[model samples]
Target: VAGDEDLPVNIDDLDADFDPKEYDRRMQQIFNDDYYQKGAEEDDVPEVSDEELQ
Candidate 1:
């Protein structure tokens, strides 16, 4: 499944320092619907003593 006639290219290769802010915003908007907010809330809670990792 490897063909070069219509190859996908790296975005970074096209523009060495490209920052597509709108593309980023759209992705964040999609991902922010659930898990992102939940993660933020979880980060705010304190960890219990016995649950601490080695």
Candidate 2:
């Protein structure tokens, strides 16, 4: 949760108007970032030792 991605809503930004589209976009970005991070971690390959080749 950084910058506008912060879960806590700001009274100043929502003083009068609430944009559902903007909110959805921000949430989607957060989810995508998390999803990619998980994918990158899973893509890592473990090194095999030569001794294990027997």
Top candidate, metric lDDT: 2
lDDT of 1: 0.54
| Model 2 CA deviation exceeding 4 Å by range | 1-17, 36-54
Error of 2 at 40 (Å): 11
**Residues 1-54, model 1: lDDT tens digits:** 134332324465356655688557545654554646655775896767865763
- True-structure lDDT of candidate 2: 0.65
TM-score, structure 1 vs. true: 0.26
User: Cα RMSD (Å) per model?
Assistant: 10.6, 6.8
lDDT of each: 0.54, 0.65
In the range 1-54, model 2's lDDT, one tens digit per residue, is: 354353544564457466888778755765676666866896998899999887
TM-score of 2: 0.31
Give TM per candidate.
Answer: 0.26, 0.31
